[model samples]
Target: MIMVFGIGDYGLYEPHEGHFAMVGQEMIFQGNWITPHLNGSPYLNKPPLLYWLIAFSTKVFGAHEFAARLPIGLAGWLGILIAWKWTRQLWGVSASRIAALMLSVTVGWFLFTHQILIDVLLSTLLLASNYFLWRVIYQPQSWVYWWAAYISLGLCLLTKGLIGIVFPLLGFLVLGLVRQDRKLIRRLRLFRGSLLVLALILPWFIAVEQANPGFWHYFVVNEHLDRLLDRRFPPDYEVSQISAFGYLIITALWCFPGILFLPSVLKFTWQEWRQGFRDRASTLERQYSDGILLLAIAAILPVIFFLPFSSRLIYYGIPAIPPYVILFGGWYSRYQTSVSEEQSDQPLAISIKQSYLPANFREKKRNKVVTIYSAIAICLGICFVSTLFFHSLIVQSLPPVINNSDTKLLMFIVPITLGLGWIISGIGIVRQSRFALLPVFLALIVTYISVVQGFIAYQDVRSSKTLIRAADSCLNIDTLWIFEGSREIGTAGAISYYLNQGQNYNAKDIAEHHDTGWEKGNSGRIYRHVMVLSDGGKNRIPPNFPGSPPAYLIDRQQLQSYWNSDRPVVFITDFLRQFNDLDDPENRNLPQGVGKPSLIINNRKLYLNAAAQKFECNF
Candidate 1:
């Protein structure tokens, strides 16, 4: 499946897409593991732990797509196992099983597990820390558990920076305060444990910073603090003006099926609390209560911290999902009543037995029917909401050329999946079987659909090897290859890596003058063969360059004359005169006078390049 998808061929999206892969490749090529580099300069965006893992994996697996993505999938699977183990210890076997099932099948988990991103790895660390902390809190006599907790927390820091440590600590503090577990709070060994975490996390920062000056300032100050507080980070600075309250509201809406059960879970917790914790409850009941409270705190704390931050993305809430699932599982598990209570022996044995006997069959049947109905309604509601959202996304993404029938066919898939889930849940409800099992089935279907969609989208919109192929084609050119226009790093990075084959490549902006030192005598010129890959829109060419009134106005006579010059220039643009001049018949003659046949590839005119000869002959 991984190979079939050509996952290795796909690069990361813009804004940090090439970062991990590029750095990891450099680590392998340079045989240096301490300081990360890109284009032979210090790269300090993230810690080198993930890069190191990727590099090591590439070394073993031969640097393919599966090797890069293998760690994330493994991390996700480990996270599920940890969640299950910890939940079983804290709550019980049933709740732990349900939690594991939910984590394994969630759409977010499924999507991230297959990608070469750090979110899933971060999630695994955070969840592991939470699990270990829970173990320590419950069994405070175990110093080993506390050490394990510190180790996991430190690794989390390595995975995604300070927030990984900060969020879990915040959740623990909140849980302690709410539970008033004074003994647990005082015996936490904060001083020693914190030092251990720091000890584990600090070396990388110190080493990387010493090796590369200003690494701390740029990564810690700019990327971490400034990005959150100022919102002036990469990609774009236009912040979402939504208030903190608005963020909370939107997050609740986005959480979907999980959020739908939040009210019910809270109601159950409140009822348990009002009953008085010390009044009358078994040891099992107390443990369940503690687990629910801890899980709730863990789930809500991260969301609270992220709500105030200026930037908000959905994936920021990934770590919270597991705890939320545990909370839901704990709440549902409590509703089960045992039917094996013994009757008392008395002088009137028959009368005593009758008094202690279970309820009538008809009454039991009624209770079962009611539980079934409630479960069915909840499943139906969730399925309906998910279907609506999926349909909305499909409708918005439909291309203009798609026919009505095609659009309808595409849109119907979501509702069909929804209907199928509803039917399965309804059957479970009627049979009085496990209701939670229905969600597991639904999640499996959702995961399958999401993976399929991701693959299809990758094929349709993503050009896997365009830059690499183009770079490979121009490898032998003696002229300095100048990448003109903006510093969109994805295009620039891919070109640099493939063309230079990990060597440094010189880049100059279109606005900047061509350096005369490199350009002396034709061979000395920095870029003798300029490869312009532009969309060919207006104002794309620099105003400083003296050209024949842009490519649009150049006639065949002018073009021939310009080509005859000693220093030939290639202008790449997507300016298709035929498409642009279609609306104006008077301007139709503009495309006809060139006498140049339009360069076509794969049945489409090359809108990406103006100098067809440079690329056309090579391809």
Candidate 2:
């Protein structure tokens, strides 16, 4: 219930969910599934895979917010399952359980799970591919595992482009090289695997390209290459960059309680190296080496791949979390190893036995410390979950008029949750739970939090119906046109999606499509009846514009000339307060000879052209 109930609503009000809904609606309306076109031309900002998934989902569930976000929630849930299975395969059931619990409660996973984005889907598929890849490496005879890996990789490609494949492929290759797993490499079937990957991905690429001319260049080259190399795209288009070392620190902080075991993990690993890799040695030693290596690789590889490019974002590190959690689980598993009493003649054997055994009283005390740390981690997880639930409840209870207060209050929840988690962790240092109680308690907390957060998200989505309705009213206008002056594509996309119901309208920018006869023979007759939606400020009209202004301008002089008389023109803007000072006649310095707006609407001010009243309404 938590996963699906509130999944659609949490952040649906803003640019994210609204924009996605627009794209999904367009796909349905146009009846063109292959090429996702926005405002009429080919939209190459992202891969078509996510849109295709949402379209298919909307067809099944209906075009509602919950329906749109269903796939992402499902992917997040599935990621937990895959994390469990993969970790269990590496370190046994106990570790798998711990890893799964860790992932279930992590802040990043919790927040994004309810969002209508492609990152979770990409992460889930990547995990699946990694799981299968691990199986192939461990059991080379399993051709099915190899096939599964490639298939998952292909799906991941569809989800988020090349980085999906690049991160995992590089990690796997580098790890294999480090471990000198020659047999695994020697039995490689690259031909068959490549074929499977191609078969899965090529069909969509070929079909979409054939359907939308220039689709390949814009999506693959311009979006993927040009954006990365030149940063010529819009400011919001790229991810922020962090130094490789800073990434490690942020990742460690993000991982929190799980990261607390790093020292022990390292100590355990060193013991293993001294012992010579042997099965009979301490399990703790073996686990520490394995966990650290895997976690380090997972945590570091994605950052390395994205660091070179100027773009970086918090979610870019998402793929790293699962492996890091698995490492945490492995470290937790080592606590079960029993100390050996017998002294060994062999130096390797002695090191292994000593590291594995809690031989001395001091070592036994150390074991207690480790147990307390695990307890702390569990407490932190619970606190994080509780805070999110509280914030959701508060937000849901408040009225729309209190939106600013609600937003401010909502921001406090995460930090408080983190602070509380730290306090609980501190408490765990002094108290040791009875054997088995901590794990069970932690499990309950994780499950409760996941379900609760999911529910809140559902309610959020339901509340967003009003915003959608508002956008819908604008769509009802027969002569609707969007101005590029102050309107953002993000907002425009959301409005367009809701209004157009996902149909491809070939909607054009007011300036760019001005000459296409939209305003030609119609003149003021066309302009009089048409309802223009604009940001109503300094119209920074692009140079070498293709079309005339759509009956609106930031300049009073342009308005007077266009209107043919100083009747008054209506100006629409969300930021009406910004124009307050400009409205003052004393402060208004006319540019050589220019006039100011004559009237203002709620956010929109009307400065009517006296001659405009004489023109016939075309509609």
Candidate 3:
């Protein structure tokens, strides 16, 4: 509930989430459950499962950010719990707890689960589907679990189109190859499961195809195959080509702190290899190792499978973490139990023969714990010092950063608290004091939450929510023709969203708007109530803003000219409130003839070409 309630103040628009919200709002407002649209034009970007969730959420919650993200957040919790249950069954209760916590705190899962992205939802379904499939394979006897696997596969298809099914199929194929079991294929109940999956998934595809003639071609050929093969696609898709290693870097980053356990992994694997695999292990121990191998396959293969592709995103790494967290949790649990015993008499080296790595490299010796805690303390001290003076650092940054005065001493509380907390925790951990460790853990959580808050504040500055709300008083939104280019989509979407009051108007609803962007049109004060353009002298003004030719180049002079006219026109552009006065080094290169804006919105400026009446209607 906390994940999806009262988010009016959290104002920021990411690339995909903006479109998702627009479609959801359109669905609620237009009552069109099929054929989603963006800016009044057909939105062919993705399937509608996520949109359905967002639409329903907005319907109940009144179209707030919380509504936009609640469904995915709920889905994330479901994924975590499923992973926890599976890990517990495979390992133990402690491993399950660690698995849940690890999944929640991993950089990728932590961030993506909170945002309105289909990837996280898809990842959850993927994990669930794979988990059930594993159950059917290893712990099987029940049709119920098989049905669950089939249902998860079908829903996965709904969540992310083809890759949903493709991922599971690939994973199953890998598992069969790893086990050298040719009979695994026949044992999977391919016919029944495939039929069940089709039964669940085909209706939407058939309906959408019938309603829109080319739905299949666009969604499959263009969205999936083209991007998969080319990595880059047409400009309409707005994707850039990425190197094969791009996603690798992202994967490592997403699994942060977890990846930091590599040395531990190497250390433990070496120790295990030195001890050699004994034939005396019990069934439960054998199952644990088997589970780890399967998880290792599931976690690592998706990353490698993506290597041939050109397109990449951090969220694509989401699928890789479930197995990763499970394996990690298993290792941590084992280490906690084993570390109390004698040290291994083996040299530390990466074992090339052992395919698996350990979560904890070495036992948590006293010296090692001290070193780790001491390093953390030093890092926190630096962060604390930086926080004390971070505002001055921000003042010299880009205009998008919020500038804090040297005197808002209250800002120091969070950093100081964190720094001191880290120091205390480090000392406690080094001394192995349980009481000190408790507050230290709490402090770590506080530090994490504080980082989230800091991220929000940093991103909030770049948000044009303030500018859009302020400009709300000066424009006739019902008839406004805001000009926005590719780079300006964030601001454009925000302005359009505010103007419509969280209602999504289709891209083709131009009778009430025009965002034709700066393509080659001329302007000579012909616009009626108000106009908002974003380039703001950054680019040569298009001769025609919403149309072609007959447009004057909009610069400081042209904006000021319109602002001074008796028949006033309001022009909105992002600007620094005190551009020349800012401590920013970029101010040294300010345009020679830049003039003042008529209205200042926080730090972003607005130049108004005012008419006798400005903002005749309230937003």
Best by lDDT: 3
How many pairs collide in each candidate, listed in order?
Answer: 7, 32, 26
Task: Report lDDT per candidate.
Answer: 0.53, 0.53, 0.58
Better TM-score candidate (1, 3): 3
| Runs of candidate 1 exceeding 4 Å displacement | 1-11, 179-182, 231-256, 270-276, 279-288, 336-397, 400-414, 439-443, 446-450, 459-464, 470-491, 494-612
Model 3 gets an lDDT of 0.58
TM-score of 2: 0.68
Which predicted model would earn the best TM-score? 3
**Candidate order, TM-score descending:** 3, 1, 2
RMSD in order of candidates = 10.1, 9.2, 8.7
Report the alpha-carbon TM-score of model 1 versus the true structure.
0.70
Encode model 1's per-residue lDDT on 315-346: one tens digit a residue: 66667777777666655544432222111211
RMSD over all Cα atoms, model 1 = 10.1
Q: Write the per-residue lDDT of candidate 3 for residues 194-271, one digit (tens) a residue.
A: 999999988888887777777787788777887677632333332323466777887888886466564554344334
Candidate 2, residues 1-619, lDDT tens digits: the string is: 3445465544354345555655665566566777664433345567777787777788888766677788778888888898887666555666567688777766557667766767778878877876777567555798788888888989888888887788777766775676576664454466777788889989988897777556676676656776567553444432234655666676665555466676765564444344325646355444334334544666667656666665555566777666667666655554542223212222222333443442332346446665566566656656656666567566667545443553544345544545454555444433432133244334434444544454453433323333434333432233223222222233344434444443323334333423321221111221111222332333222111112333322344543344453332222223212444444333232222324433321232222234332333221
- Residue 123's C-alpha lDDT in candidate 3? 80
What C-alpha lDDT, on a 0 to 100 scale, does residue 237 get in candidate 3?
A: 30
